[model samples]
Target chain A: MRALFAFIAGGLFGSGLFISGMTDTAKVQGWLDVFGAWDPTLAFVMGGAMIPMAIAWIIRARRDTPVLGGTFPPPAPREIDRKLIIGSVLFGAGWGLAGLCPGPSLASLSYGGIGHWVFFVAMLGGMLVAPRLSIRLDRTVPAE
Target chain B: MVMDWVWGLVGGLLIGLGGAVYLLANGRIMGASGIIGGLVDGTGRRDAVERVAFLAGVFLLPVLLYPLYTSIDTHITGNWGVLIAAGLLVGIGTRIANGCTSGHGVCGMSRLAPRGFIATVAYILAGGLGVVLFRHVLGVI
Candidate 1:
């Protein structure tokens, strides 16, 4: 039951990305291009998404466990470490360069062509290497 | 003009609805990066089936809906070097930071979490700066 709901949620999310023009890298890049012919479509998308999500969180506050019987996710992380800032900056640069984030990147895989595959593969490689790199970084820099 | 906004709103609502569904039913945040990242890192190993099911939904829905929507043009960079670099950054950055647009932008901010807000601002600002530097200044992408 939980898995089914997850599947449905994924489908809905993907459908939204497809319908919102978010699956189009050009559209995404256009929104990011503030100095150029900027498109405000993504803002509406973000706003629209926030409404129901905000409501969900409110409901969450009242409930201890979900309908399917699991503890709610823990509170959001609060620490503002170097990894957070640097990673965000790097992610943003990549987002600017390619305009493909994980959600859309996964959703568009079927029709994404060669370029999409390249990004996906490399992204996977990077994810694979990150843990090891972080371990090394941890060894170099004492725990905070 | 108005139609684009409408589409965006409708789409955004669906995305939000999806997040709500996951939260209400499974007691999990529907951040794509975290969902997929956990699977890769073995952090979400206990919930592998759920995550796989979720991803299958994400991937397969478009296949079924392909007929309804207009053909999508990704406009992803063709340059291999740029693509690889961008992919690596996105992967490492999202992993190290523990969130991305969906996790921080939508899920985090919705809950009024400070980390979410900060990460969102940082990424958006970095994205804007990157656009200015790469698109306007470097002219490479």
Candidate 2:
């Protein structure tokens, strides 16, 4: 039952990504192109997405457990650490360069061509290797 | 212009609805990177079945809907080198940072989490700077 809801949710999210042009790399790049022909469509998308999610968060605050009986996700991590900043910077660079993030990238798999495939494969490789790399980095530098 | 905003708003609402469903039904946040990231990193093994089910829905439903709509355009870049490089960066970055646009930007902000706001700001600023460097200064597209 929970899995079914997850599937439905994923489908809804994918459809939304496709409908809103979020799956389009050009559209995403355009939004990032502050100096070029800027497109504000994504801003509207973000605004639209936040509305119901905000409500959901509010509803969640009042409940001890979700409708399916599992404990809700813990509070968001509050640390503003080096890993957060550096990783985000790198992620932003990649997003700007390719105009593809995980959500849209996954949703685009159906029709995405060779470029998408390369990106997805490489992204997976990076994901696979990141933990080890972080572990090494942590050992060398030590967290402050 | 008007149509763009309308479509964006509608689509965003749908995305939010998906997040809401996941939160309500599974007691989890609908963060794509974290969901998939955990599977790859082995931290999400306990919830593997649910994650796979969600991914199947994300991947397969779009294929099913493609024929009916036939209008969605994904302008992914053709440069293999750039694609691979960008992919690597995204994978590493999102993993190290622990979220992405959907995770931190939409879900996190909606819940008024400080980390979400910080991550969002960091990525947006960095993304904008990346655009300036790649598209403008470097001309690397």
Candidate 3:
């Protein structure tokens, strides 16, 4: 049941990317153009996402237990440490350069979008390597 | 921009609503990263059927929607090699960050998670800088 819920959610998220013009790298790149050809579409897309999310969260918050039978999973760690900063930078860079972030990239792949596949494969590789690198570094270097 | 916004609103609402319903029915955050991660990390059945269907919706929906609106025309000017390199880097970033834009940006930020907040900010900044540095400054744009 939890898996079913997750599946539905994932689909909606991907659908959002498809409609938002986010799947188009050119559109994304246009937003980055500040001086000459700036596009504020991304901002609006974000707003569109935020408004509905706010409403849904309010309803969910009132619930004691989610349908799957447990309390809401606690948020991941909240620290704004070095790892957070570096990881974000890398993610953003990839998004900018490839014009594909995780959400849209995967969604795009469903259509056999060439770019999406490229991004998806690499993203998976990165996910696998991150923990290994962190553990290795943890053992090799003293904690600050 | 207006067109994109309309699409975004419709898309977001549908996704959010669908996600909420799923949450209400089950009890999971509809985060793509977590689902995919589970699929890849040995929890195959957890995401195999549902996630696959969800992904199919993502790709096919555009084709369905295009008829009702302006068609999306994508022209890639970058070399495949460069795009692939960037993708690999992004993959790593998503893992280190513990979620992707969908997980952190859409779902995480909605819950007001501090980590999601920071991660989203980083995502925007990095993406913005990447465009300027590579596309604009470097003439790729």
Candidate 4:
């Protein structure tokens, strides 16, 4: 049941990504190109996706357990720490550089050509090394 | 017929509905980075099946309906330096930050989580800056 949920949800997410123009590298970069020939469509995509998700949170509050039998995550800690800030900055920089994030990076794999594969492999390597790098980060800026 | 912000909204709705389903039914946040990152990093080795299954679905859907999306154009950078650097940054950043566009921008912000808002703002700001630096200044890509 959980697997079923994941598969269906994944399909929907992928379909939306393609349909919404999230998969278009030039379009994504255009959205970020505020200083140049900027595109404002991504705002709609971002804003629109939030509506259903916001409602889901409302539903989540009244419900106890999930339909497929799992515990909902506890509320995220209300801390604004170094890890999050630094990490997000880095992610944004990379996103701007590539015009692709985790979801679309994978979604475009089959047909996004060699460049997509290169990004994927590099991203995978990064994911593997993140924990070690994170440990080092913790050493420098111990969490509060 | 012109692809404009309307399609963006529709696609956004679908993405949100996807998040809604995963959140309500699976009892998970449906953050793409977290789902895949956990498995690769060993923190989520126990739930390998869940992660792999989800990925399979994410990857397969586009191809299964290839006929419909044949004109898919990603326009990804062919510059190896940019691709590697960008990919590494995204992988490391999203994992350490504990979310990405899907988790933080969509799921996290939707719930009004402070981290979500902060992360979203940070990434957007950095992404714009990245454009300035990588494209405008360096002319690397």
Find the candidate with the highest lDDT and give its number: 4
CAPRI band for model 3: medium
Poorest 10 consecutive residues by lDDT, candidate 2 chain B = B69-78
DockQ scores of the candidates: 0.82, 0.84, 0.57, 0.85
Over B1-141, each residue of candidate 2 has an lDDT whose tens digit, in order, gives 789889999999999998999998889999998988899889999989999888878888778878987465677767888999999999999998889999999999999888888888998888889888989999988
Once superposed on the true structure, which residue ranges of model 3 sit more than 4 Å away at CA? A1-4, A110-113, A137-144, B43-53, B63-70
Candidate order by TM-score, highest to lowest?
4, 2, 1, 3
Judged by DockQ relative to the true structure, which candidate is superior, 1 or 3?
A: 1
The local lDDT score (0 to 100) that residue A78 gets in candidate 4 is 85
Kindly report, for each predicted structure in the order presented, the TM-score of its chain A compared with the true chain A. 0.93, 0.94, 0.83, 0.96
Per model, kept true contacts as a fraction are 0.83, 0.85, 0.61, 0.84
**Span of 10 residues, lowest total lDDT, candidate 3 chain A:** A1-10
The sequence of per-residue lDDT tens digits that candidate 2 reaches over residues A19-86 is: 78888888888898999989999999999899989999999999999998879999988877777777
In the range B65-121, model 4's lDDT, one tens digit per residue, is 667754767888879989999999999999989899999899998888999999999
Task: Flag regions of model 4 displaced more than 4 Å.
Answer: A142-144
DockQ order, best first, reads 4, 2, 1, 3
> Could you tell which candidate, 1 or 2, scores higher by lDDT?
2
- Candidate 3 C-alpha error for residue B1, in Å: 3.7
lDDT of 1 by residue, A22-108 (tens): 878877888889899898888998999999999999999899899999799988777777777777877888888898888888998
